[model samples]
Target: MTTGRYLAAGLLAATALPSAASAGVTVTGVSGDPGFLTGRIIYTPGGIGGNAGTTSADLSIGRMKFTGFDTATAAALAFNTYCIDIFNYVQNGTFDLQTFTLGNAVKEEQLKALLSNTAGLIGGAATLGGKKDISAAIQLAVWEIVNESGNNGYSLSGGLFQVSATHGSAATNARALAQGYLNSLGGWSAQPGFNFSMLSAVSPANNQRQILFAPVPEPGTWALLIAGFGAVGGAMRRRTRTRLAYA
Candidate 1:
């Protein structure tokens, strides 16, 4: 078991931009416990289309074993750290926990209905030829609820998402569920979400756990991004003028 925390090199970047910020996940406080595995995973960001397509790629961190038994406080604190970072990057300020509410549980019936309505949704990948994959973006949202709510009810290992049916260990049953929906809809077509990233539990030793898919920021999020650039630029101009007057 590894114990030292190191940066997650080779992190996945759907698209890379010279100025684009790097992304990754690390879970703290829960260490060496079989129940929780949160480690740091980092990836570089670059793409041919610059940051535009990269923004479209959803952030999919692999499976988080949510059993709905969360104490809320610890989880909220942990999740908020990243939320604050993201908020600052987009909103130009620190994140307040009050702004984020705990989510409700997602029962099996509700999930089934969601899939039925969203059959065949898909999105283009950010890497390579911009490969298209089943983009059931909504499923990722539901996953978050299940995790936080502790609905350990149906899961990939044995629940609705069986590893064998998914065709590979590297995928979530949610992905398979998305693919199945596509098959019925005559294959993958344009969907609302893209660039979804997977989340995995990491051990303090830097070991990987099950993957959970996390949805990325939507276009509207970037639109809301508040920046200090304007203030800085104005201050710079004023300072320059003062220097010239003194000269």
Candidate 2:
């Protein structure tokens, strides 16, 4: 059996974590219907495969082709897409065990609804006169909610859960869409509740390692970011930077 690992290249520009951060299910690969973004969280019942250290989840996006709008030009889009999130149940100092099972049917129902509402929503247009495929784009935004209260192998001990995601570039936008969905309910938030931590993208050679998407930004860097934002805004806006730090 092939153990597939996702490519961690490019940058995704989405909301930063509290300076911290963080799926697929298999009934033989669950796919969202055409024109809608579909996602599933599958459990092995005996826990996930591989290591005994930290348990991590991942979403895979296949390369897609797109075409320009007016000129009808076709081009392959290499988006730096990121911005999906996973949760471990340790919110604040207490143990929130909500990570075990997938949230009730409400979660699944809402996601399907999202796809329906966003139907026919294309990014811009594919170049080369070809239509753009957003299937991978949609998968990039899926998340895993392990154990309900969010505690897991890739998390800290006690009620201290973890969240992770890719930071910088197009990944950020993907993360934003996912965040909007999570925040819509009075349910999930990095502040006031769950703690977040961004995980370094696993090296491509080590396909055994699966990387989970989170809110972006390392846990310790949140306050620094706020200060940096203010400092630059008070004077002249600083130049934006890009990093291929997916690993």
Candidate 3:
């Protein structure tokens, strides 16, 4: 009986452990100074008890595909940080983000084709690109435009990254995404060529303002936890009652 009880307790503990999920966003050649550019955003959704949305390999990643990164490497962080800054940098040019209009596939394709060439990027030309595919196809496009236009602070070698955003209320998603990126920075105080000062709204100087990276709890995680706790408690109570009866 004692052995059975111990086994039950162990099972409960295992069931209560945290959970994770996967959400993928693919972008390429982001634009900015010191951009951690990429074509793929490497992320796995996760968190501790009561919170586990996702964790990214880099907060933002860039176009270059260098392998064998030690999670602690500055290059890794540079990639993730690029994802965070891409949005703000994209619109710095004379071209408005909304210029990517609906039903204008030709211009959108032109924009994509134009930005694909890292060697020949020119910003003024991006003013012609429309916003029809703004959210979906524009990540790399934005980086290309911004960099070509000299809109952001990213150096010539550092203007790209890939990042992702999953589902949630806009605010919750922002908070979690920003928090997730910040957390990914881990204990490192600096990210090589990347500038932390640019993140004025959520930097250490500003006490890390919150944005919605909506961290939804892992599916079935909460239910399993509750059931496991109840099971453990019930077993404990039953053992106590049994002892009392014998006494």
Candidate 4:
């Protein structure tokens, strides 16, 4: 093969390799403070005994902003994420981005359904109360899908995965709303252009894992990346030709 052809092939191979960006993530803060439901989560394996129970303080349910480096450009990337692990705590620390398939098949399917359909329901709400209620419900639904033991279905009451609030009707309403979303998943259709990622913490081994959603890059974006590689190969070939002429 000619030198130019070899250099072009090398550039293509390099672009096809996985990104070498650092996996460190920092939880900046909650996104929009949509709202939180006041309740305790009961899971035998999540460090909290089924008898003792744990409140929202222990398992915070809400959208959070996470800052990390882009896998391709290594640029600062900040996006919204939702907690998927009730067994661990969320702290400002380091985390690694993993594939979404790390969880059970049921968990993955249910989460995709929730995010695709019910997650954006809050955007259509008319009042602050409505928005907060929808946000809390989405979070509750996510918890049920991730931590629930039996694949029977998702629920916030009377199952291996349970959420209860002893104080007011807000929690109760949120639970009902969440259950509605789960029930509708039977006929849910998969949506395209959505990319899901799992953010697993590096330290504090017990830190919570989060789900980050990003839109897939457009065709134009891919074209630009390919063009960039072509430019680099062209520059190298030009330099090689100049050296040969001088020789």
Q: Provide TM-scores for the models.
A: 0.21, 0.30, 0.17, 0.67
lDDT against the true structure, per candidate, is 0.22, 0.23, 0.19, 0.45
Cα misplacement distance, residue 136 of candidate 1 (Å)? 13
Model 3 Cα shift for residue 191 (angstroms)? 22
Q: Write the per-residue lDDT of candidate 4 for residues 1-247, one digit (tens) a residue.
A: 2221000000000112113365445443222244433445555443331113443223233333333454445555445445454433344444566775634786677667667665446667798677666665666666666567766566666676666665433356666787887888787754676666656656545445555554455532210000000011011123222100000
User: Whose TM-score is greatest here?
Assistant: 4
Model 2 regions lying over 4 Å from their true place: 1-4, 7-52, 57-103, 122-137, 144-171, 184-247
* Residue 197 of model 3, lDDT score: 12
By TM-score, rank the candidates, best first. Answer: 4, 2, 1, 3
Per-candidate total of colliding backbone pairs: 34, 71, 49, 0
Residue 144 shift from truth in candidate 2, angstroms: 4.2
| Candidate 2: residue 109 lDDT (0-100) | 38
Q: State model 1's lDDT.
A: 0.22
- Global Cα RMSD, each model: 19.9, 19.5, 24.8, 18.1
Indicate the residue-level lDDT of 49 in model 1.
14
Which residue ranges in model 3 land beyond 4 Å of their true spot? 1-42, 47-51, 54-81, 84-247
Model 4: lDDT equals 0.45
Give the range where candidate 4 is weakest over 10 consecutive residues by summed lDDT.
5-14
